[model samples]
Target: MPPFGQGVSVTLEHLFDPGAVAVVGASDTEGKVGYEAMANAVAFDGPVSPVNPSGSGTLFGEQFVGSVTDVDDDVDLALCCVPGPAVPEVVAACGEAGIGAAVVYASGFAEAGPDGEALQAETAAAAREGDVTLLGPNTSGFVVPARDLLCSFASGVADIPAGNTAVVAQSGGLAHVLAFLSRRQDRGVSAMVGLGNRATVGFAETVRYFDADDRTDAIVLHVEGTDDGRALLSACRESETPVVAYKVGQSDVGDFAASHTGALTGDHALYAAGFAQYGVPTVEASDRLLDAAAALGDSPDPDGPNVGVVTAQAGPGIIIADRIQRAGGRLPELADETRERVDDALRGVTYTGNPVDTGRPMPEFGDVVTAVAEDDNVDIVLVYELFEAALGFPVDALSGLAGRVDKPVLFATEGIEEDMAADRRALSAAGVPLFATPERAAEAAGVLARYAGLSDRREAPADD
Candidate 1:
């Protein structure tokens, strides 16, 4: 069922870091589609060759080629920003020019119905004949932050920082939005690709590419619907990197999905089953997509589901505990020795059993956390700290927990002071998944536990 390993001709690197890029249908006309695409591709550090049929003057001062074949320089990638009907010929030309990959930014493909479907078929045929990996026929282009390859017309390409998370979505707009939100949450991704019409490069293949990518540590995917179930599941199963999927389109798929990529609202139940069987944690909320990815990104890979909870204020602590259980996570009973140590650290002021409430912020906050993390029972830690001067949520002191215990600690709090912002940044930069609310912190903890358990099963997968 998974036909992915069958000798794919094009190396993903050509699509990712194509040494020389050619923007087809490029011009300087303001508010024009070609104009925006050219403006965006100009940001690429590699040589960007503008291609236009008019044979007119240069837009960005680079000499324009009347067609892709006319370019003297070697072109590995073709940004097919031409109209839908014209895309096939351009891709064919790129194939003749020995280009292995192209990013098709045109719409009016399958979403436009039969004619669009036919046109998309032609584009697919061209890709096959030329051994090209076409990214999209009706989608936004991709982005690689570390390379400064902002390969899209969408705005806000400059501010994106280089990090470990990677995003692949069916919708281009959603992918960009997720990338932007991830950045806002103080998390940056290694790559962002929009899989519009799966003419050649489908979702499963994209996932596989991310899995092999050295820069990516975690993968976040947005799925509307997919035609190949085994390929998707096989990609998930093969990926050593954890995959967090934001499965959109629950009830009504709406017009955008149908018109945009001809994708229908799939059976959510079946999709959930596949994800669960493969240990892929799926989030329903759009906002939590990146939150889960960021939480899972490059830190404290917990070995078990048993969580140790700590809080300065009791109310939020209780809230986190309840949510953890409700979210199918366990708050393990503190071991006898572990409980005694926690009690001694707190000095018997508050509840010291499982959710250790310190009865107001303590100077021994870091010590108590270390005790929980070191305990035999606890595999992860959920901590809630309010802003108390010097003692409240000490980022530096808590930073030691990740290295000491080798367990993820999700830190949650509210009431940020104007002064402690840098410390907050420091904590996140130190690999602590910071959340504005207790529930989100709980969710992150749950995801970590879920992944750990599933990963163990994956290691010794049950035979069919």
Candidate 2:
């Protein structure tokens, strides 16, 4: 938007891992937005500086300064929790203090009306003049679990565990929701950013930023609308980071999106096509978007859609196979050696043709998974099970098998109970994408297979 690097040279690292952060307009009052922001910032890894016009007291033993200029510290990030009208002034102060970034967590900007639009532009100008990056003029902020920087005012920001998946969303609420859901599933996030208003930094820049982030393994994007789909697609295409996008406004809600953040809801078909062309998968649901990203994070993309499944129970395996086909994936015939090895390992009557049915969870289940993983025809492996104390979830065996193989091996199970907590933790720690349902499993595999196919096409020698 500002010709790449014309201003705001500070990157997302400044926002996520700042040396010191100042909460502008901070309040000691409970249940207030500014207060909430300050409450969260107290957990930041670096020094948390509170800045208020009064600047007369302290919160959590940290003294409040009258203003950013008065802090006398190098503030890498500033959370501007003041009103939208005062954002320009707060930004000017932050610039004067040499702050690199600010999260203007206020609404009533361009999304409000013409007057608000003018205000949003003025705020951006203030940020640019100071060479500071702005997260939102009407947005939520960002959360980095690894750095313990909860710049966001979101409630669920506290308990998020650190992991490799990075989330980027247009809606602050949805960003937090994704982060919460991911954490709940044991697939914690590296960072969750809300590109509110996109006043200065937007999706493409953020995508590129996370692409370079060493902590991030996979990236998930939630897009409401965008002006330049091509640019976004190009950045994603050039990036080695596997991206999963969940773009809303596909069904005649352009007006609402435009009013929401002055965004242009680009044609959904073009977005779909662009993503597909660039080896990116688009999920239809928000939760599924995170699911896919989590799946891709640990599971390397399949070179083809030929999936081999191992089910502790027959029904779930069949369901997985059906869903995989419905999602435009394939189930190729297992190799003779593969089927024979799995058949020999079976201790009971089970189907060992394609989706190797184990009849029930057994210790030999790991061997079955290994047999499938070694198959030359099989590009992906899906393992399904019903968690039971008798079977013990096979954590050690599966964990060991996953490491032995080069291909992607995903685990899916039904049932959730406290008793299974240890097993879940063990598998997750070993870097397995465990889905709660067969549908989710298939959806994740679809992303894996689809992206794999696209990558294969891209690597193929072009027709001269």
Candidate 3:
């Protein structure tokens, strides 16, 4: 909408239009970029045309056009898998054909070295002159969950259900990993794009687009580095939608990182300061990306940094409580009213302070949850248990209690079996979130608290 790369103005409809698509350099060989791009397009359930001089007959049982001009239908996007030397010409043709976007999957671009930089520069110049929005010259491309569009080799494992989260990553591997993690958490994605070598459109543009997107309620980013930090930070600060970023390449890792993604490594301290200044929650670990997304999606704005721990077992509760404190979150002492409520509801042996442990075979686990939920100091409630027990605490009762409370409730179960799966599904259906481990649940709560605190602080008045 606003010139591409200026800010966050691109739209999913503009990016994933299925009116027509052309896969340049479509090949007959299996596992090649051309073949994978063509395979993804064929699986798209929309109109597609393969554009390659070598693909005159047909590929994947569809007719192949020798060139972009030969296709009678208007092309919305072009998947370019051509050689680096041929990219400019192919992009020029797509622009002449009025194609809005081109997803370049070629690798010998800026990531290759100095020669690659020159090639990448030419590619960017062609796109800018032709007015085509380029996705990547060294990328795995993007995917749209609602349209069932899998446009890259990395998206093969992405069987995403319709959901509100949109993920934009700089690494192709991380993008796929995020998608897989989201699926495991029962979280669906609206769209995912890997801005490899970011020749035309950058991560900030996608973030801004997701901010305005009706389908995208949350945005998750995996960034390596960016040439324009100010623009990226500004776009993120202005967006109403929440953003979670996981950055790599903070340390010098020999020549591997540069050759892998062309990311110019920078100081972690600088990146941390930048994130803090812009109110972007930066995650250090990969797993926390999904954790933060799940927690923020389900919870109300956290009122405080205090987390109330509830567990069937005392050991796991203590472990989680320790992790919460280690992550700079407070496990608040139960208020006088809360202690009285828990004492009245549970066995006398139950520790009635911060870590509210319902002693084994407790008669009133539900009432205990109700008491904790009512605590004025508690910003979030975390429950932990193993899946092997025959008679576990009533999760439905806990869900009901959580529903009544203004705070968010997260569960950490022990097993990965069908029983745990059933419990997760049931809790999720009741609007209570689930996590794999107590530590992960605690980490998620910490992130939620951090975001809430940052959001509460108002921005300084702008200069004229």
lDDT of each: 0.81, 0.83, 0.76
CA deviation > 4 Å runs, candidate 3: 1-12, 158-163, 361-363, 388-393, 398-404, 457-464
Best model per TM-score: 2
Cand. 1 TM to true fold: 0.94
What TM-score does each of the candidates earn?
A: 0.94, 0.95, 0.91
TM-score of candidate 3 on Cα atoms, chains taken together: 0.91
Per-residue C-alpha lDDT of model 3 across residues 210-253, encoded as one tens digit per residue: 88888877788887877666667777777788888887767776
- Candidate 2: stretches off by over 4 Å: 1-10, 456-464
Residue pairs clashing, model 3: none
Cα deviation at 440, candidate 1, in Å, is: 0.8
* Better by lDDT, candidate 3 or 2: 2
